[model samples]
Target chain A: MEYQRYNCGNCGACVAVCPQQILKLNENQVTKDPGCDECGNCTIVCPLGAFTWKVGHEV
Target chain B: MKYDVVVVGGRIGGSIASLYASKDDADVLMIEKRQEIGTPVQCAEGTTQSIFKILDMKPDKRYINAEIDGATIHAPDGRAIDLAEVSCENFLDGTGYKGYILDRKVFDKHLAIQAAKAGAEIMMKTTVKDLIRKDGRVCGVVAEHLGETMEIKADVVIAADGVESNMARQAGLTNPNKPGNIGSCAQYELFGLDIDPHQLNFYFGREIAPGGYLWMFPKGEDTVNVGLGVRSTKKTAYQYLNQFISRFKGTTPVELNIGGVPLSGPIDKTYTDGLLVVGDAAGHVDPVTGGGIHIAAFCGKTAGQVAAEAVKKENTSESVLKRYDEIWREKFGKNLEISLKYRNAADKLTDKDMNALAEFLEKNKIENLSKISAIKFLGKHPHLLMLIRDLL
Candidate 1:
């Protein structure tokens, strides 16, 4: 998954729903720690559309 | 350090739990990750008057932004249905009105102060990175503050952590929710608005908020909270919010609040040996409307009272702590279950269905609506009857 940091609110909505528990929010920033299956949960729950599919994962 | 109770998260749930435990003569400590208690407001800030009743305290004017008396529900086709003041606590169970819009920044800090006054020690900017488990029971937390790590010991550890909660998962009480079950919310506090300050407004349509609805809650005469919650939508909640706000010609946002609400109802269980989960961590939110502040406060107070009693008895085992689950569940569990079922049925409603329902409501007194009236209404709308037949 890719992130558009400008639109990111760093609210941790992604962190809450991430099954892999790979996303981290600290000091108003969200960072990923790999091992993502592109479940698209972040894309769906994000208020700011900061995350997008990393291509080819599209149905 | 050892304490009788350790509560994670410094929001409404944590503060209320700490307050009650301390008031009950149990030593308590609350840990918060943020530098301040409620710097960035996340909620729409509307809550029922019963919140004050639960706290056993009067409503303080310092944190109340508006005292609401009524509400107007706007349907997709622009039909407005007004609701008067009621005794009901929330929208899913009843209609609307008799509420207050709180300034959470002030309200949260005030709650922390109340906890402090009750002898509960609080630590801001302290993050609980992990729970300390002995054998199979949670008994403490491994926390980090200013890059320094320490293990704080407790007989009962209450997880009041918010939606991004890790403590509850570690205790094996809950799992990550599906995207469809989370309410992705975004809001803006606007400075210029022309609307009834004492009357709340809600706009509904898929084009507006998808699975949820748009709300305008007045904070002051000239300012209002405009927000919306959406679920499983192609467009982001922020995008939808921006689109809705564009209609207002001169309004400018003074603050932006965004967060996720757990709308799947309370978890299956909220207690284990030496562990109790409260607030959003336990999904103590209304599944239909995504409101949890008052519920969190109520559950927090219950957890605190229960934990303090368990501490006095020198037994914080699951057998004893499970009483916490039983108490709150008995009081609120059935309501949440019914709301979840209603939300599922409402999810299938189209704009036409909502408009039709609004039309029915405009002519009829929603407050006096009974099962017979609902059946009669459904008899006319077969499409809606098919969608909500089981719910009836």
Candidate 2:
């Protein structure tokens, strides 16, 4: 998955609400856990709509 | 790029900070990572009129959705108490106290525009990658703007970067929130709502919200912002919001927002060498009410003024900038401390205690009480007093 590099405000609202606890924020970039499932919870919670799933990428 | 002040985050706090700094003749830049200033609204969009007075801003119809005359609190068992009369007496100079539900998108954008007009540069879609520290003092920021990495230098950096502030950590300040200190929230703007247009409604119960309350604030004639906040719950805020929205069978949400609020007091430290933290990043919110817009504006203005003075004096050291903390704390710290005590005590209250408190409000015919007043009233009861003795 490719997150919007410029749009993540680093608010960590996405990290806090992620059900699987797979999203980790390093400064402004969010890294997904290897055990991630694409539940889209992070996307739903990000205030800036910063997260996006790259096509053909499977978690 | 170089500026005297670089304010990260372009919402209310950052914009306001930039506005004051620019007005003080400091070169200022406000950066926001979002494409828009206030898209994907995160709050219930409710605030008191006192905020406008603090900012010396006149109320604009363009961003006001509704003027709330009073509020009604619903007990878990459906008992209701209206607060109109007492609220009027205490807050409104004997006229009715009116809270406002704002169109946050418009309101935030307006504040940013005000900052820009005051000579502050605003850069949207700019994400601060990290703070640029020189000899353990923050001197600038590395940010990504338009897919390009740019290093922006500043004499002072203000972190208005919302709830999860990387700047705070970069400055070596402890996190402002603890596990139970934050409340998860989800809000929905619904149309075709059948409810009182002038009174905000709050519902309290463990089942409804484990450690917080749910609210429905009227937006316009037939619309409302319905939301809930909860802390230390097994259920997600979304689940609680879903269950709460199920009550309004016919109403459909026009907008959905999920966010978090710091329910603790302000952070112990809000200023570091060459850096200042304001607004949600500083946890300048009411613990009991989960309100921060006013506090954010208040602290933002203070930080900006202090930052400008420091810049002019060539003393942006932590010792000099610490005045922002002292001034804000002297102004509003006691209230926040009291709110924290009350929140901690109230969160421990049982469902039975809540029912009893509701009963007391009903039986005593108390129309409204401030958080402190409510705590005092509850303190009068031996049982309730014992429950919250440590807080008292």
Task: Give the RMSD in angstroms, all C-alphas superposed, for model 1.
Answer: 2.2
Error of 2 at B120 (Å): 0.7
Candidate 2, residues B1-392: lDDT per residue as tens digits? 99999999988899999999989999999989888888758789988887898799999999999997888888888888776532235432123467788999999999999999999998888888799999999999999887799999999999998877668866877543454666777778899888888788999998897788999999989789988888765566777888888887888998877777877788899999999999988888898989888889999999999999999999999999999999999988988898888887887788778777777677555444467767767677666877667876
In terms of TM-score, which candidate is strongest?
1
Q: Give the per-residue lDDT of model 1 (tens digit) for B1-392.
A: 99999999899999999999999999999998889998778899999888888899899889999998888889999988875522234553343457899999999999999999999999988888899999999889999898899999999999998887789988888888889999999999998889999888999999899999999999977789999999999989999999999999998999999999999999999999999999998999998888988889999999999999999999999999998899899888999999899999999999999999988777667577677877899899999989876697
Go through the candidates in order and give each one's C-alpha lDDT: 0.90, 0.81
The CAPRI category of model 1 is medium
> For all candidates listed, what's the TM-score of chain B alone?
0.95, 0.93
TM-score of chain B of 1: 0.95
lDDT of 2 by residue, A1-59 (tens): 45786766554766644545566554336676676667655554454457656687553
What is the fnat value (0 to 1) for candidate 2? 0.10
Determine which window of 10 residues in candidate 2 chain B has minimal summed lDDT. B85-94
Candidates' DockQ values? Answer: 0.75, 0.14
lDDT of 2: 0.81
